[model samples]
Every structure is written in C-alpha cells, then in structure tokens.
Target: MMDMLLRPRIILDAAEAEDAEALAEIHATGFRRGWSADEIDALIADKTVSSHVLRRESLFGVRRPQGFILIRTVADQAEVLTIVVAPAARGRGYGRRLMEAALRALYRDLVPEIFLEVDEKNASAVSLYRSLGFVEVGRRKGYYAEDHGPGGTALVLRLKLR
Candidate 1:
C-alpha cells in the first residue's frame, strides 16, 4: 500500500460560545442555508452533544471549521445529529475526519450502535456514511429544511457495532 505523509494540524476542541459566529458564517458559505449566527450559537451552546470545533491557527489566520458532528448518547446508542464542513473546506477530508472523531468519541463512551439522518440528495455524504458501514434504515418525508439541489427527503442510516 502507498504510504501517506503530512496532515493539517487540526486542534479538536469543544467549541466556545464565542466561536459560533464564525462557525455559522463558514457553514453558510458552504451549504445551501448558512445557519444564522444565532442558530449556530444555539446549536453549539446546546447541552445535548457539547458540540466540538476543529481549529488551526497560523501567523496568517486561524482556521475554525464551521461544520461539526453533533452527537448525543442514549443508553448504549449514539445518534449523530448533524455534520457539516465549511464551503471552502469541502473535498479536503475534514468531513470524513470529523465523522471518524464522532464515531470514536461514541465508541470511547462504549456506544454499540450509531445512527444519523442525511439529505437523500447528498450523494457524497451518503457514500461517506456507507463507506463507514452505516446502512439505510428508513426515510423521512420532506425532512430537509433546505436542500442542496433536486430537492429530496431525508434518509436515516444506522450502524451497529460490536
């Protein structure tokens, strides 16, 4: 196998309340409906998942990802409430890494199963989740508030781990 070398220095930390504005801006730039500053703040400040943020600081500027994986645990099960990558950061593997982190965090919590909802039109995201072993379990009619394109419903996926 070919060896990979070098990686971005991403500092994974819980998002501070102050980071919400930047987060929402980045998300808005990346997705169809960029969350409002207030919305992002609410999501991050929510007690449910204790949301996380990935940051990288340099002399030029600090890179604070607007997207995240919001997960919550219920008994032995974990649910991924949301996952996003900044518009400018897509295709850079941040989404996948964030996903891996979320899964690992849940695993560390001894969660044996995980589930999430995704827009069915988001083929890229669906592929990623499937690659990570999540299978489609159901669908929600008109679940997506805003759409990427083609306007599709939400798909529910689940992964059961040993």
Candidate 2:
C-alpha cells in the first residue's frame, strides 16, 4: 500500500476538446446510459458548457484523468450536465473537488443559481450535493431506468450561488 499523503498530486483544470474520449470512458463507468465520445465531444464543443477534469500527476509529471464535471450555463443560471469519478478513483475526494471548482467558476461568472438532477437512489451522490448546499427542489418520477430493476426517481436540486 502507498501512503495517501505521499500519493501523486491531484490536479484540477479546465478540460479541452481532446479529452472527449477519455471523459466518455470515465462516464461509461458511472452511468447506466453513458454518452459516447462523439456526444462528449459535442458537449465540450458547445459554447455554453464549462468542463473541468481532475487528474493525478505523478512525480515524473505524467497526468492521468481521474474524474470530470460538465456544466452548462444559460443566461444567469447553470445546470450540471454530468459528474463522475473513475471507479478506481472513488473515495478520494475527487468528486467534491470537481464540484467545488465548478461552483467557484459559476459563482465567479455571476450565475445566480445552479441545478442538477440526481437519481434518488444514488446515496453517495445525493450526500455530496447536499453537503455542498444543494437543496431538493423537485423530482421526476421514473427519470432513470435501471439495468435490471424498476426505474428510479430523479431528485432535482438547486444551490444558490449569488
């Protein structure tokens, strides 16, 4: 086992168009209906979207993408399109780091609020959003179809930024 503190430094930075394939790979691990590389490319290409990646940089300066967050801003509001951490990178505070960075960017842009819809059954995700000051505002029944079970509801959450 390696010392957690001594682990390679984690870098959070803006994602570029070239990262679509890698982001899609990470997205597939976290979602039931994952977006393809082309879909991710289109989203990243859109002028309204802001994308960020969390990467682990080795002492030798090799960086590997570990997680990402995508948000779309319209007018004075923003919505989180997706957020996911690679399965191997879970439980390492990467998700929170991504969210905090995204929120800061949105806030700095003077966005009034941000919203996201999360599957109600995703306890870890719900907890993370709540810890970041997101409050449940609405829900969509049967918003997410499961692989082998009944569909789950999507809880709409909002956080005031301004």
Query: How many clashes does each candidate structure show, in the order listed?
Result: 2, 0
* Residue 81 displacement (Å), model 1: 2.0
lDDT of 2 at 141: 89
Clashes of 2: 0
Q: Write the per-residue lDDT of candidate 1 for residues 26-54, one digit (tens) a residue.
A: 76664667778787778676666656676
Off by over 4 Å in 1: 1-8, 30-32, 60-63, 145-151
Model 1, residue 104: distance off in Å is 0.6
Q: CA lDDT of 60 in candidate 2?
A: 82
List of clashing residue pairs for candidate 2:
none
lDDT of 2 by residue, 35-151 (tens): 999999999989999999999988788888999999999998999999999999999899999999999999889999999999998999999999999999999988899776668
Compute each candidate's TM-score over C-alphas.
Answer: 0.80, 0.93
Candidate with best TM-score: 2
TM-score of 2: 0.93
In model 2, what is the error at residue 88, expressed in angstroms?
0.6
